[model samples]
Target: MTANDTDTDVLIAGGGLAGATLALALARMVPQLRVTVAETFPLASNAEPSSYQPSYDARSTALAWGSKMIYDQLGLWPALAQHAAPIHHIHVSDRGHFGAARLHAAEYRQDALGYVVDNRWMGLCLVRELLKTQVQWLAPAEVTDMTCHGDNVRVTVTTAGETRELSARCLVVADGGRSDLRERLGFQVRHQPYGQNALIANVTTADSHQFSAYERFTDSGPMALLPHGSPTRASHQSALVWTLSDSELKEVLAMPDADKCTRLQKRFGWRLGRFTRIGECNHYPLALTLVDNPVRPGVALVGNAAHSLHPVAGQGFNLALRGLMTLVEQFRLAGEQGSNPGELAVLQRYQQLHRSDRVQTAGFSDSLIQIFGSPLAPLTAARNAGLMGLDLLPAAKRWFAGNAMGLGGRKARIQRPGFDNSKALNHD
Candidate 1:
């Protein structure tokens, strides 16, 4: 399996955002490497995948500034820009508290703190980009089992009702938070539940969002709203994510849309004025699921399969993007040294490079929850003071802003994707 005896240089399982993005990166950054993706969902085979038309109910994701830079280097940002809404400012506050923190992109000399994009649109865009790449794809396929042997990992993939075995120098598990492939591959996991669930939806307000994001901390839980644009309509809409207890979630789900909006409005305040109209509500349980050493000799896990984080801080996908690029950089190094991507040393180097980022990103989100989760009078006072302090302390604000934009600690200087013979390090 080690001696140039693999089907591809890299075989990625799961063609979701993580898998697709990783494939695109490898195809662009390391063009000499062979990459294939196995996905359970069927993809549009046409030269042009379906494009996005404005809709009120589509779910969304918040992409940090650093993520945007990475996507720009991949030449996908301009396409995404057409559908994305930039977050020029962020307002963080404690409900009913005197202290609040505001982050203005102009103050930081950045164009945007982050962006909000529709999930379906982004997925289709990724699919379109993948279609233009040399990376191979296996659709309606699943890596049912994986067995690592020698220098390569062999996967049993079921594609179009046919069972086949494929060997790859490196295997990436990007199946998501609940990955059967990861379990089958024996990746040990640590899970922690937050006793809360996130209720996500799109809502219209009385006033324009003006390219702002809001994060509100309440005794019940945390809530966030990011400006969401409608291409076909004029209603001022923002994506809503409300964390609630299990009982609260059930109650809200049973309530009428108007009542649910009332509940959200009560918690989030009159920042954007009234919640005029509410869209479909989708909910997710909050938890932290981290896999121990998500990489092995010939295999590795990326995205939610490796670490599932709380969404309040919007760090999950951004962190995954960082990790994904880090892996590609390691593979670049391996290629230069004439080493296999699946070799233990190569994958381990990737892990080491990404470990600090993973820890700090997780810590940032966890600290927010822990600091604000407690509603005791003393802690509430301290939390308010901390918020005010964060606003006043330039150094602290810069650090927080950098992390929020996915640019904190140990930088990665990305190169334009292609074969790079240049010796400029991607990280600073």
Candidate 2:
């Protein structure tokens, strides 16, 4: 039950996006370190590409600029570029209101405010990067059991009908929002369900999206239009995320695509012109879940295992990448200090580094969701007033844009070609 009882630098559970990327980051940062990832999914292969048809998932993600920076560092952006589209502007409004506040890339002199990417395509691209790294890929493997000792962790995994013991100085859990590992380890998390479900689908619009994103708050919930590329049949397309009350979700899900499109078109109005067709629709329940603490001695939780927020703000992946950045950087510094990368001190450094950013972003997201989702008349007036105030303050607008791009979080500086590393100190 101890790392000294076995071998390896670190053991990562769940080789999804977070686990794979963390391994990739650690390999790049600490080249000599041994990082093994245990994943139940089949190893990604060129023949079996991880492409999700809109007719299957109908869901996509918006990655902030900061997340793009991480992808750029991991050499994933180039591969994702073909399928990803940049959102140059964002329009936010109340459904019953006429004026909508717009945030434009031109105002910030930036190429794009953020990017919209198909989640499956992103996974495929990340898997490709992981393949190029030296990190050990334990695929088709399930963690049957795990235990932690004073300074190390031991894990038992079953792969290909055989059991194997894996020991490491620390364990990283990145399973998902409902992490089985976390539950098995007796970690307590607070989960708040919104009693709403997001109905996702791809819609063909008469007018082009013009690379702009839209978020409209209706009485039911928030509806987002993420600009997408041309449809499969050479038509203007946009990804829809329509959040509805639980009762409404069931009604919408039962309708055929044509009927769903008709209802959506009526509810959404003709802003993007009439939605001619709907590709596929799926429902996802909205919830807020967070672990009390991310770190406990030899254990650490990364990505969704640590926290899951409402998708309205598109901060889930951004927060995960941010955590990865901090952890990898801490490992780098630990190695430089002649210490084991997965030791308690090193792990604590990683935890402390991300605490501030995590708390701030989570609270910010909670406040925004609660304020905007409320039907209180006074709060509604205040919300509009706040938007109007933001419109008047150029500096505030820029800051908001920066935050949406994930730049509001602490950013680690990458040493340049001629920079003096000895003189540089950790900014945070």
Candidate 3:
């Protein structure tokens, strides 16, 4: 076959976290398989990660223990540890509420509850690890079209001022929630808009965060304070992901630094001390988006392409990682059974492995947004009551905590109480 007709075992489109992670997982799990990743952005060091970083978003992700396990298996966590902040506790409260329920890593006998990782740092670390994998990385490339043939799928990519054709037994979409490839493949997405925006920024706390994550719910939405690496020597830093009303968002964005810090100080309370300083603030529209299905013929979707949930709980990446790990396992099983890992049967297996988790997590997140985001008096009271009830039940509390940590269900293996190893690979 000519170069244009040459085929790879698998072709992955959209090289963000999901795509990159999937490629690495497949390379490690499926031996001798040729994999190609087509990414739009030129692979660059984290020194400059897209226009998104210009604001120093100071944003961080709360990675569940499960996500950590996958990273460990991929040998990515060791490299990422330098920039990670472990959360030893989580305090959940409500605005105008008298009491708050707290979850402690000590209760679980784990080293930490979860980890707070800067997106830039983790993304760069993943890219660095990706460079070491056997998977081919195609930069500044775009997938123009894809067609499923009798035994293979043909993918056309536009890159470097030329059109190139590549065939693979299977095609994987690792794009974001709004996957262009998913649309090209005729997958339908269901969208649920919260009609709200989440404002994110890094701030300094007068009091040491002591590596705790705080989730305080208000009538508007949830305000999440995620621990970050130490602040400047003079300041104690933490990442804030706060949801706000439209007017509130506009007001906050327009506020002078001093006024904004004062407002934040009033709401966040003295637990972390006054908000002396705030980093560049950014806002993201909140939504609950999911796909009807994640697989089609030789095509499979991983990460955000499969599901994007409300970030209030911060399990988006953890869920994506779980799906990636399952896909890897399914591919390995397909190979051992003498079946093409990119074939319809293999894709179906991965779908089955993910179907429950996808539906449950998506449903859970949507319900949470609806319940907590609403201003109805009854709903607010009920939600808070439920939270209080959960606090009273040790088993239920552990289950909820496990879910947040991405360690829920039979496939999950919880590590140390405060530590997450869900992203790590279990050799045995």
Best by lDDT: 1
Angstrom error at residue 92, model 2: 0.7
The sequence of per-residue lDDT tens digits that candidate 2 reaches over residues 7-96 is 778788898878888988888777877888899888755612355443333367888867876777777778777677788888888777
Clashes of each: 1, 0, 23
TM-score of 3: 0.90
Clashing residue pairs in candidate 1 (N, C-alpha, C atoms within 3 angstroms) = 413-426
lDDT of model 2, residue 219: 73
TM-scores for all predictions? 0.94, 0.90, 0.90
In model 3, which regions exceed 4 Å deviation? Answer: 1-6, 45-57, 230-235, 413-428
The alpha-carbon lDDT assigned to residue 181 of candidate 3 equals 73
Tens digits of per-residue lDDT, candidate 3, 177-231, equal: 8787788778888887888898888988788888888888776677888888842
Query: What would the per-residue lDDT of candidate 1 be over residues 185-234, giving only the tens digit for each residue?
Result: 88899999999999998999998888889999998999999889842233
Score candidate 1 by lDDT. Answer: 0.86
TM-score of 2: 0.90
